[model samples]
Target: MPRVLHTAQALVDVILEIDELPPRGGNANARSERWYAGGAVTTLIAAARTGAEAVHGGAHGTGPHGDLIREALARDGVILSDEIRPDVDTGYCTVLLEPSAERTFLTVYGAERQITAESLATLAPQPGDLVCISGYSLFEPTRDPLLEFLETLPEGVDVVLDPGDPFADFPRELQRRVLARTTVWTSNADEARALTDLDDLEDTPEAIRRRLAPGAAVVVRDGDRGCLVFHHGRGTQIPAFPQKAVDTNGAGDTHTGVMLAERALGADWESAATRANAAAGIAVTRHGTESAPTRAEVDEFLA
Candidate 1:
């Protein structure tokens, strides 16, 4: 089995660089246009770029957009799972970038939203594998499949959870189950606060730790403020690498991918989070969601 067995969506992204976001019922002009692959694949590719053996499997549309994402994944040489849905069209997102490089995404989840338990059962994760679970999946209507899949992970397979959306909206029981299975949990600063009702950033990790079993790590990432990693009952803050972020589109996904990759490779928490920070730092400096740094690029950046 690959070190990282990731089950998530990979969709094409349509990028429009605008001076500012348009007001509701208003229009805006674009400075430029670009198309690239994006979404959960961001995490898988970022991890694969680190030279870790990686595999991605999930339902995706078989449309032209899916073709774009498929070609992109092929170029990276990532192993793919045969769970594609040919009847539906792949999802795509329109990413609007402001002058400050912040992004606003208008997404329409497509074929990928049709994930089911039968498809997920195809994943044969072995001992020591890391199965990436995204909150995006939880938002889908097929909760039964997701619950079943999570409950069925092999004993040696550990879960790394990234509650991808609305931390507050996540069902309490789902959170409870995932936290129980999670070996490492990642969330943004705001999500962490919402989930734990903790204000002190330093205190959030501890609060999260209380929910997780011992030996699990909680990573609270505050964009530009850096990140905190809590493992074995101790927390360490790792400062973000300074960069002129051109687009903040997939920085968090890049961080997640790199971190998972490093952990699967036996790196300690500090080392993995540090490398993930560097990888995300490089990602935001470039354009497009597939902008994760390669192993050479990350090493060069660190050097």
Candidate 2:
């Protein structure tokens, strides 16, 4: 019986403008726009929607953005145990999209970077709880505290590490420290390559499982191609369901969150991975991170 806790950056994302981006340099014209809640908040939302008792622990500032984050989480049934710091501005990111649908992001970390060891300690995990730590929260000042908190967890609590792109930003030694204790690790192809230092990303999931924690499961997500799951000395690749992707922003988070929920509920690794892939496929067919589908939607997709 693993109670779930989610920790990471929580931010507002504004889709600045959609334009024709030249492969080389020059920009084009503004077309469409939208905004959404981002980071582990999105993942926590997904987890809660799937019937998991999820609590979000992260830093936000007292402002409109912070309100949006809190309101959005509440709407999804996630408990907010972490407080918003006084007067600080919540973080935001501006996304630039090209005609090819490729995206470039300009982010302001804002209050997310202000998370301290004390803040992490406040959300300490009890026995049989699972702590989901995000990669974006593991760089610089937050890194030490995040690691310290992970180390302090009571025995028997599971730790799931979703080292987003920030996995590359960490020093190898620091990354090793986190992975050593992680019961599960999730990332995409590029992230897998960077973290494992392997050029052949197709082999990364197996390599990472072998080298890091032989018993730990590894999930390597490949956009459009599908996702691969490595566990128990076996590998399974699940194909991505066909869908017209409107935005792929939170697909990975959705996949990871759903996978965790299914596993927590006693689903087998293959079944959980398949369910996760279907959930993420549904996520991409919609706009924004919070648009991730409900458990019913995933069941429908699976059916």
**TM-score for each of the candidates:** 0.96, 0.92
Cα lDDT computed for each candidate against the true fold = 0.84, 0.80
How far is 59's C-alpha from truth in model 2 (Å)?
1.2
Count: clashes, candidate 2: 0
Residue-level lDDT tens digits of model 2 in 1-303: 555688788889887557555466765666777778888877788878777788877887888888888889889888877777897888898877654556688888778777776787667678666689988777777778888888777777778888877787777788788888887888889999987788876789888886554478888988877888888888888887868876777889998888887777778888888888888889877778797788998888788
Q: Model 2, 56: alpha-carbon shift in Å?
A: 0.8
TM-score of predicted structure 1: 0.96
RMSD (Å) per prediction:
1.4, 2.1
Off by over 4 Å in 1: none
After best superposition, candidate 1 residue 204: deviation in angstroms? 0.7
Per-residue CA lDDT of model 1 for 43-89, tens digit only, reads: 88898899888787777687898888888888888777756686788
Candidate whose lDDT is highest: 1
